[model samples]
Target chain A: MTGRTIVITSGKGGVGKTTTTANIGTGLAMRGHQVVVIDTDIGLRNLDVVMGLENRIVYDLVDIIEGKCKMHQGMIRDKNKLELFLIPAAQTRDKNCINPEQMKELCAKLEREFDYVLIDCPAGIEQGFKNAIAAAQEAILVTTPEVSAIRDADRVIGLLESEGLHRPRLIINRIRPGMVKRGDMMDKDDITELLAIDILGMVPADDRLIIATNQGVPVIYDKRAPSGLAFSRIAARIDGEDIPLMDLGPKNGIMDKVKEIMGINRGAYSNA
Target chain B: MRDLIRWVVTRKENTKNAARNRLQMALMRDRMDLSPDIINALKIDLLAVMSQYLVVGDEFQEFGIRRLDESVFLVSNIRVKELPRANAN
Candidate 1:
């Protein structure tokens, strides 16, 4: 079956590209779609740890491309989701070890079997970034509310357009709602107006995200976590479900909660 | 307590607004790959050329390179107050 290959990228580092890759991959798998996440970060491989499959990576992306092992040998199944898999990058090799042509060939092979091939792109506009986006049919740019990340994202968007990957959707991560309310941080509207891209989803800054990563788990499994719910909604949207954007404003009062319980109000979270 | 006083003093403009304004200006130049110096020089040259044929206003309503769809254009909207003398070379 033909599958969709999407590269989760951000020109600036530490903006949750890897985390978004892991969560969205797991989120899609939890919905019963067969998925594989390939980390193209090379020497700085961390998708394995994020997916909690670090100890199970016998063969890696380099081995699969170098013909040292079969594709299935390099694929590591997730601890919980059987349909989800991860192809970790080679920790010893440099980004120059692989090229765009090889990456394209590998993605072509994987697309024939899986429903989704999520490429975790490295941070930068260098060789690694080129190799990651070479074969992807779609792109999801991750960024924060800060200026530097947005600036870099704008540049990456221009570069992606030049490369013929048009209309890359945006995912704004680590948004602090309180700060947005206090007029201290940029909101989704401000960012979208400037970036001029379709918003895939908005994830709030949740402490649970850190705890989940510390436990070697993606936060999408934490039902009580707001950021986890955000990721699941994003996955649903990616799966062709028309989930409306969540209202990420401040929490409502007790009276509003009562109204929500009575079905008179849909509450602040799902007001569309 | 100190934050309250500062908030009251700077009530007209917040840091977020400052960021938005700065980002917009930066992106305008960045999207066209034009530096501030180049934009300033172009503005002066265009006004100078227009003044030879028409009584052009010193201030331009809009002047910059903007992207529309797949095409990029050097858009300029200068106010022409009046036309020059017909016999003037």
Candidate 2:
């Protein structure tokens, strides 16, 4: 099958790029698609731990690329999902170990096998980031509502465009609605206006996301988690499904409950 | 009562507005690959060139670099009163 390779990237660190990669990879797998997530972060690999497949990684991406092991041997099956797999990065190797040509060739091979190949890009605009994006046909840029993250994201967008990867979809993660309402944090409009990219999804700041990461289980499995629900919607959109974006405003009033029950709560219940 | 007292006592503007303003300026500079001073100089030079053909007004309705889709444009909306006289032989 000719699968699509998409790189999940955020130019800044700790903006949920790895977590987004894990969740979206799992979300696609849950939809019965054969998916493989490759962590191109090299020495700073964390996608395996986030996916809870760290123990299952007997062979890694470097091993397969170096001809030390077969492709299937390097792929580790998920603990719970049958269709999902992961190719963990080499813990001891640096980004200089692999080049863009190798990554392009590797992704071409992976695309022939899986239905979706998701690459978790490294944090900077260095060799690791270039290698991560070299193989992908599309990109999903992750950023927070903060100024620094947005600035870095804009720079990455320019770099991606210069490399012929245009119109990268955006995912704004870890947004705090209270802070936004208080005029302390940037809102979706403010960011979208600056970035000028189509928004793939917006994940609210959820405590359960951190807990799920700590437990080595993706937050997408948590039905009650808002961030989980957002990722699921993003996955559906990526899988060619038309789903409305979720509204993450305050839900404390009885009027909102009544409107939600009547199926008219300002598009908040559209996906629900 | 505490909220009201603090609201009256504090003169702080919303920090998000400040962030939005700064980001707008920064992104404009980045997309054009030029500093604000250079952009200002370029704008003046462009206006001077345009005034050679037409009677350009002193004020501009809109004049700035704008990004739309995949392109960055040095967009301007200057008031043109009339065209200059043509040379007669």
Model 2: runs farther than 4 Å from truth? A252-272, B1-12, B35-89
DockQ winner among the candidates? 1
Residue A82 lDDT in candidate 2: 93
Which residue pairs overlap in candidate 2's backbone? none
lDDT of 2 by residue, A198-235 (tens): 89989988887899999899999988677888899999
Residue A77 in model 1: shift from native, Å?
1.1
> What is the C-alpha lDDT profile of model 1 across B1-89, one tens digit per residue?
99999888897567898787778867877887777888898899988988877898998999867666534578889888997777866
lDDT of 1 by residue, A1-272 (tens): 99999999999999999999999999999999999999999999999998888899899999999999999999998999999999999999999999999999999999999999999999999999999999999999999999999999999999999989999999999987768888888988999999999999999887888999999999999876778889999999999999888668656688767865775432334422
